[model samples]
Target: MPITEFLTRNATYFKNDVALVEINPEIKNIPHVTWREYSLIEAARGGAFRKQLTWGEFEKQANRFANLLLTRGIKKGDKVAILLMNCLDWLPIYFGILKAGAVAVPLNFRYTAEEIKYCLEKSDSDILVFGPEFIGRVEEIRDRIPRLKDCFYVGDECPSFADSYDKLLNYCSSQAPSVYITDEDDGAIYFSSGTTGFPKAILHAHAALVHSAKVEQAHHHQKKDDVFLCIPPLYHTGAKMHWFGSLISGGKAVLLRGVSPEWIIRTVSEERCTIVWLLVPWAQDILDAIESGRVNIDGYELSQWRLMHIGAQPVPPTLIKRWKAVFPHHAYDTNYGLSESIGPGCVHLGMENINKVGAIGIPGYGWQVKIVDENRKEVTDGVGELAVKGPGVMKCYYKDAKSTDEVLDDEGWLYTGDMAERDEDGFIYLVDRKKDVIITGGENIYPVQIEDFLRSNGSIKDVAVIGLPDQRLGEIAAAIIEVKEGFSLSEEEVNNFCLDLPRYKRPRRVIFAKVPRNPTGKIEKPVLRKIYCGESVVAQQNEINIK
Candidate 1:
């Protein structure tokens, strides 16, 4: 079925039930305001506002938006790009595009004007629906996108050149459109988080989205009464697909406005959230807060918080161990997926196999995963590239045939660039990105292994390992670390911590600095490499500080 049907179904069955709740402290003063009032307040004071959408209201808004798109000549297969942060309008706008038989393109809210323009032009997007936060950037690149026919603003003030989202919704009917959206229709274009280079537009069908939601629901086992806490940007597939589990199951979801540990804990307690999906850094931050005694577990009624899952990066076994100590009653899981595969849950670490903490678990529901060598032959025991075949896999990278052919094979398997190994029990352990491996004097070193080991150090808060050019050894390992606040670690101390590792695998140089990461919490190694070693410049042999 088309993913929009999920919203329609939920609206019919749970009309009065809350579908979404947006929590923000800025909205504290504007309680019970109408949509227009909220928009005006938002325009004047910015997006510090609280809002809630019942199933019925959510569907009605989506229907209204679908009609608006239809009125503006948008039809099946047309691209409608949405650029907004996590807010009440994000999902409704997404579903509306789907219900109108249009392809939804979600741009990263953090994209620069140039990046935004690139996506719009590359996707051949016909319409741009953006928020106030992106006004300056949008205005800067607005003229560059010749294919963009219409611009709609989803905030308090609509620019003279664009239409107001609130105004359109008010004028349009709440009735569902007559569009016949099918499962095979184009659903969305989600840009890959650019770790290596410019983000690729991963295009997916409606069936893929439905499959993603079904997989998440099947694995997490959400009920109608369950509440999911979502903090990540909806533009990301990880956050949206995770919440789809709740959406498909007709459960409530809370979109948190802030990222503080106190805000998350308090919301889980107050909203009685049952499921929460956290990225690695957020998970670590939450654990550190509780361990440091800054957040008292007893202060919140988190008894209803049953399931906690981590994704978007490697799941550190140690992080889970500490989390279990505090919330022993919670069942933990780790999900693994990529933008090309439509988001997390193509492979999942089931709660039953919590003992295999570091592994990403077996293939997810209706998905097949295998480790393959450089020749495309399956590797039963050793580390190789992880390949996934499933209904959730994207049709192709939008408008880029060469890039698409590189990753996707004729047999419909997506060759994930992640290097991995499978255990005797069939659990898959991620080694690192195939391109991320450091080769020093013909010895291969996985940065993840070193980063994981260094993370165990009490003085290091976060760390990223990268390869720096060396005159004698081609490339050598370097560790960029972010020391914990008020904590100091000497280069000698870092060296001593890695003394247990083999000489070839140990980081040769140490630099104390904040480790850079993208919004999804994946280390920006390319950025790090650029900072430490200039784009074309190599490090001098004397710069290698190995003792």
Candidate 2:
């Protein structure tokens, strides 16, 4: 069944119950009249500080958008692109596209104008619905993209070249469009982070989306009363798929606009949020704030917070250890996946298996996992490329068969270009990305090992390890350290701290620099590689699979 069916059912059964909340303290200062034109938008009980939607309103807004698309001649399988930040309209617009039998293509808000044009032409998207923040960028490429036909502006004082979504949605009917949808039909297109080069389009079917909803609810056991706090960009798959839990259970969720430790804790306390999905860096910042007296731990009521999970990168076990120490009652989990596999649930670490904290856990519900060598043979207790087969795997890398074939194989296994090892107990641990492996003197060195070790130092805030050119050795491990503010660590100190690591795996070069992380919290090693190595590794790193 289509994912919209869930929204429709919730609208009927839980019409008056709150389905979504927009706790945007950043937008609180903006005048309420600015958003008054938007019909689906409404203030919460406390007013403009929190915009919200009931289940009934959620379905109605989606229906309006769907009707708007269908009336504009949108047909089944046509692509509609969305370029917006995390907000109440984001999901409704997404559902609206699916309801109209058109595929929803969500673009990263950080895309450059050229990148946006590339994606528009690549995805063959004719209709792009963007917000005010993206107006300048979209304008620069609006005429450049040959296929682009319509642009819907989502903010006040809409641009002349674009139609006003707020105004247009009000004129459409609030009833579901008469369209047929199926589990196997195309539903959505997601773009890879494009850290290596240009982003690739990942395609998924409606069944894959439905599978994620089921997997999330099964994994976290989301209840009707559960309120989830989401902080990541919804343009990416991680936040949206994690929110699938609330969608499945008819629970409420808050789309938080800020990431400050104080703000996060305040929203959780004020909204009575029971579940939160955080990136590793955000979680670390929260812990650091509380421990350093930057935040008054006693000021917030956190007793209602039940579960906290992290995903998109190899979570430092030490971080989770600190989290558990702070909130012993909280259930913690780790999620691992790629856009190709429909976000972070193909292999998930459940709290039940807390003993395997460092491992990425076993295959998720209705999923199969294997660690295979280059010979296409399975490896036991050895590092190799990780592969997964599941209901949520993408159908293909849209319009790119060669790229799709490189990762996905016949019989449906998606080969994740991540080096991993299976423990004797069957838990899997990610070693590094396939391209991130540094070969020194024929010895394969995983940077994560050295990076993880260096992070143990209290003085280090963040770290990235990459290969710098070495004449004698094929490549040498280099560590770029981001020292914490008010803290200092010398190269000697970082080296001494790495005494725990094997000699060959130690970073030969240490430099104090900022470790860049993309929106999803994955280290931008390609950027570091380009900066330090004086060479772009874009070609070698293009196949990088985000989890």
Candidate 3:
């Protein structure tokens, strides 16, 4: 039941059909958070890029890479790490490793050199396949990592230290490698986004991968004619699992490179995309553009677009309200899950239940959900940690038994760190992250509650709430607001906006600053905590709360 079987089936039935499209936004401002992203755009520039891959070509490329790995002495259960951006070769390289009976380990493109070395050693990876953007980083720690025996470059102008991926693929056969893979076999290892720069690896069996595809297709009801537009980095779970819906139905997909509202609309219009998976910030930007008249709705061919779903963070209900107003015919959903649960779809908002807009919805297909308190007792009406049980749950934290036992219990439920409350109607509402809770004067303050309130203001573009240490109250809530462009906002204005909130929950201080988010669009509160007050201080406070 390996996920590769789906790829093979599609190749058999839809050999000439377009399976993937790489939409390149050259010289366009694709939003970036770090200097490393600039290097990727430069390396990926020019006319030599492979823009599209048919189902047949995609399957053959995977088989060729698998054949090359088998010839290189790779064996079953060996680890092959992939460090590449979202491109035509990214998925081929990933599927190639799985087809060879080797575990596919995907590293974040934003990872530093030390992180790359640490993950390689931690997962016991023997081979590395990377794009040109990571050349200097790989070279920086080449001699330092003794476990890595081979490196393959996916771009042009091969370096002397690594073999050329394209050249090696041409030399190998396109036939499938001789490997016996089963549902229970370990298939992939995904790393959690460690805000502290040290990520924890999560392992999953081939069964989990297969289950993700089934769940995606069942939830979204994808068809052969539907085209999916993917915008996020493929290394993350959210983007890849969403694309699984297309794979299950032998449908087409577009790998969009940019997040600008203009580029996204243009790609959807030209590609005739029927489904789109977007993050919270990207959806908000699109709405702002349409409202400000910067983007005319009548300009694009959007009648075919049917569904738009978002994930990776708590989606503000206001955003969806604005979206439904503009595109009344479009059905929207929001998914909730973590790396431990094989991406998303364990819990999702059903399109039919549009009235329950603020809730994250009930358990997904073949999944069960519940809320439990600190003592492991189920809480029906109160806020507690959200837990889910499903086939998509990870086998364990890779090589970290102690950490795995902390979150996963013997009953088979994966305890998500998100605090939530189930309403009388059985829909669940996410309160906030458990670790992000602020304690001031023995009162608990969830940042999501305050952040959602601030986002309702038209003048505020984005916002984040964090705790700063207080000598007497122990800690105090601080709001960092990002005002909309061309709109002037003041501390007095924000304070006035908070008069409706309870006195204890109001932000103790107001600071105007641009909020930082990771690649998945989740606010980097730990980064904010470090900038406003040391992260160590917040960590110490949480430790005291546990006591």
Candidate 4:
């Protein structure tokens, strides 16, 4: 089935149910305004807005947008790039593109003008639909993208060259377009975070998205009454796939604009959210706030918040331990997936296997995982790269056949660059990224192990371990830590905390500094490596210092 069917089915069967709730305080008191009015208001007072959409209303708006796209000559195989933050209209706009039998290319809201231009040109997106927050960036690159025929503004104001989203919707028909969309048709183009270089576009079939929703629903077992709290950007597959569970179940979900720990807890309480998908940093922040008595957990009614899942990066076992201590009754799950495999849920730590906290758990529903060596042969025990075969796997990297072939095999297995080990019980434990393994004197050291250990220390707020060049050992582990507010830790204290670790496995050099992380909370190790290890000779010097 086409991915848009999820919304269509929900609208038909559960028309009265709440589908999406957007909580943004910036636009709370503002009434409906036109493009010119919005521009004036934007210039006079900068603020945000909120919106809510029921199943029926959501479908109606999507249909209206679909009709608008159809009327504007968008057809099957046409690419529509979406540039928006998390909002009520995000999904409607996405499903509208699908309903029109067009492909949706979602751009990262944090992308620079050059990056946005590159994505637009590379994806061959014919139309660009962007939110107001990105107006400046869009304007910077608007004339550069030659193939971009139209630009639709989603907020109250539309520039002279673009069309107003609300006005266009009002003028279009509120009936679903009679388009023949199929499972094999192109659905979305999700760009990979360019840790090493520029982002690569990973294209997916409509079937992949539909399969993801089903897999999410099966794994999480979401009910219609369940409410999902979504805090991450909608452009990310992690957040969207997680919300697919609630969408498939015809449940409600809240798009929370704020990301602070207090904001998350308050939104969960106010919305009575049952399921929340969080990244490692936010989870850690919430735990730290509660532990420090900055947040009074008893003050909020979080009884309805039953399940909490973490994804996007390696979750430290210590963070989960603290969470369990606070919310003992809540179920915990962890998902592992890459953009090539259609986001998280390819491998999942089932809630029942809470005892196996460190493992990434088994292959998800209808998914197969294998740890393979350099020769492409499966490894039964030792560490190797993880290869996944599943329905949700991407079709290929858009216009990059060479790069696609490097990762994906002809037999439908995606060779993930993550190194992992399989235990005797068949549970998979992620060692580290293939490129991130620090080899010192022929002994391999995974940074995740060291980072997890250091996170357990009370003084450390966040930590990242990177391999710095060492003259004697070739390469040695270095710990870069972000100390918690109101806490102090010297290099000796940090080294003493890791004394129990094997000497080779322990960090040889310790530095006090802020741990650099992306919006998704994954540490930017390349950035750290560049900052700390500028040159080969500089990195060879073993020293402890504060930055």
- CA lDDT, every prediction? 0.85, 0.85, 0.86, 0.85
Kindly list the per-residue Cα lDDT of model 4 for residues 379-470, writing each as its tens digit: 89899999999899999999999888989889999998888998889999987666676756434467776788889999899999888765
lDDT of 4: 0.85
Model 3, 59-122: lDDT tens per residue? 9999999999999989998999999988889999999999999999999886668769998998
Tens-digit lDDT track for model 2 on 1-547? Answer: 8899999999999999999988776654444332333212434433455678999999999999999999888999999999999899999999999999999999977676887898988898979999999999999988877778899999889998899999999999999999999999999999873224456899999999999999999999999999999998898788999999999999999999988897798889878899999876678788889989998879778898999998866665667788889899999898988888999899999869876888899999999999999976887767899999989999998999988898888989998888899877888888767667675643446677678778888998999989875533546789999999999888888888887665777889899999999999999887887797774234224423330
**Over the stretch 318-428, how does candidate 1's per-residue lDDT look in tens digits?**
678888998999999999888889998999999888999999899999999988999989988888999999999999998889889999999999998898998999999
Work out the TM-score per prediction.
Answer: 0.79, 0.79, 0.78, 0.78
Compared with the true structure, the alpha-carbon lDDT of candidate 1 equals 0.85
RMSD of model 1 against the true structure: 11.2
> Which lDDT value does model 2 have at 67?
96
Query: Clash pairs of candidate 4?
Result: 26-48, 27-48, 27-49
Model 4 stretches astray by more than 4 angstroms? 26-50, 193-196, 436-547
TM-score for candidate 1, please give it: 0.79
Better of 2 and 3 by lDDT: 3
Worst 10 residues of 4 by lDDT: 538-547
